[model samples]
Target: MRELVFALEYEPGCNRVADALADHPDARVRSLSLHATAEQLWRVDHATGTPDALDAIEDAFLTSDYYADCLATEDCGATQTTRVLDRTDDTLVLYSDWERTPSCASVPHIARDHLGESVLFETRHEGRHYTWRLIHSGEGDVAAFFDALEVAVGDCARMEMLRTADTTASVGGSDETQSGLSPEQEAALRAAVEHGYYESPREVDVGELAEHLDVPRSTLTYRLRRAEEHLAKQHVADERLPEDPSATR
Candidate 1:
């Protein structure tokens, strides 16, 4: 589930639309509506959980000038699948209903008007099921504004996911190198192993070995990790690498 802000062009006291809908038998508590702006309508729901008939409801609102344009079709009604169906002239619908199944827990929130004008919103991603309204004081296409907003929200989500993955890999040895080190680093690693630098006598602390090799401690650790990874890989490739193939010969 995600939260979304809606920027509408309604008159004062028009915020009751959501409350009225809430009284309906079909409305879900998770589907909340609030006024973020006097002219706007804010709504929230599970993007992936909504019914397929939402587009029809949206079309209903759009054709009716945001519900402020007065009801035309006698069949203008709502179902559990239709959370909002407006018929007012000043009432515009701004919604966030994009959903993905087999999806991550995150939802994208958006707030824009019919002319695509932007309204105030919190961070790049929608945290949870939320609905709020914003008054679009500017002149812009609501659809275009929302399109851009969606793109921005999506980009932010991607960046956050990538960053989280990178951090996790760094902390958990996720990016084990094939060679376990660059050529130079591997040379140092071989030297450390042969010199018994990593053995139990405490003959060489990491810092000491790093200094002896004229390399930084950080560099030594990195090389060691690489070396370990490489050796492990080689052990898998040639099982004899661990017991000294030269000794057997």
Candidate 2:
């Protein structure tokens, strides 16, 4: 099984929810899972900053042409999902299943549809784009997948591939290569590594790193995630590249 993790950026012009998220700098959507069939169940996590931002999101979602249920929420935000349905402002009747309706063409929905039988993992929205991580049968059909996505977005947005890799085995016999990091990400990840943070939950967490660095916890979290992502991408790319024939020189 070949697994690929790619980041898909959605601009405001693409979809309503994406636009709402862009308006709120701190707001983000983390895709938990998507079960597609007669009726699609989209499980997602949402985070917002101010009351106005929250209100905007609610307006876009609750009034949407589907059944939505709020499962949980806290200071950070909430997690929820919408049952798949296709409705418009002009239509007052509601359909219980997607067969009777047009269907909502979301990024997650489109990507999952394109992949067909492949398994899709958790999808995350950092700030600008929604990151989708999935595993496929290694058919190598990335170009075709993006073509479908572009059509879904309707020329409103385009996707940028941040990272992709095959997870069947270690490409270079190691998880990561000798790559450098940005100043901020380096500091945060370095501190975690110093304490064996990745070693079976042995040493420390982000909070400890924050305390040690005298920086805010959120700041540290952002830096560490980005840094780790960079290292991981490098690892995948390096493993896929052909070996150097003149290394002895």
Candidate 3:
């Protein structure tokens, strides 16, 4: 199997959902499930953020056009419907189903055209960036897909190919594990460690670190806290003892 990881950076006003996320940098949306066909697309997404951010996201998804690739300027004869399956103080589970028209440009349709129907997709959205991971049985027409995607996006967004490798070769082991940190979280943690922010004599404060990273202090703090939380949980899991001690034997 082969894996392709890519990301799209949307320009302002390109996509309403993306713009909403950009407005609330602390909010993140992850695909819990997604399935697409030539005629329709169905997806379930999990979002986490403050109540206001979640509200904005839910509103955006419901009120805006639901083109998976981006926003559609002209009516493509498509229709979208959304539902809030669950909600909490800081999380939301959303479900959406959209009917597609031939004129509609979406990642699933493009992938089906080039990558075949055997491909699996996973996606995450944060700020103005949408990242995708695809796994397919064969190599597929990657170049053609990229070209087609670029044309579809027009001048609204930039597409980047992050990685492409054989799944078997990349799956197994790594010398340094991140304990499930997202790219943003990893960056925050790395910067903090390098700047001696964790040292007893604290070389830099949170505000200073945020300035160095060129991000808002609140955003930096959120990333750091999330990263630390993941690391702590991972450490506890690793050190956990089996309920039945004889299992070690």
- Counted clashes in each candidate structure: 24, 0, 0
lDDT by residue (1-249, candidate 1, tens digit) is: 112233221222222232223223132223333223323234443211124233433443334322321111232332112334432332323443322222111122233323333344332111111222233444545456555544433422111110101222332222223443345555677778777787888677788888888866645654575458657776677765477678989
**Ranking of predictions according to TM-score:** 3, 2, 1
How many residue pairs clash in model 1?
A: 24
Find the candidate with the highest lDDT and give its number: 3
Candidate 3 per-residue lDDT, tens place, 1-249, comes to 877777777878888778889899889999999888878888999999999999999888888755545335577878888899999999999998988887888887788889998788899888877878888876579889989888888888777554566678632123223445656677889999999999999999999999999976756775687579778887787689467768767
**Predictions in order: lDDT:** 0.37, 0.53, 0.80
Error of 2 at 20 (Å): 1.8
Score every model by TM-score: 0.25, 0.51, 0.72
Which pairs clash in model 3? none
Q: What TM-score does candidate 3 reach? A: 0.72
Clashes of 3: 0
All candidates in order of lDDT, best leading? 3, 2, 1
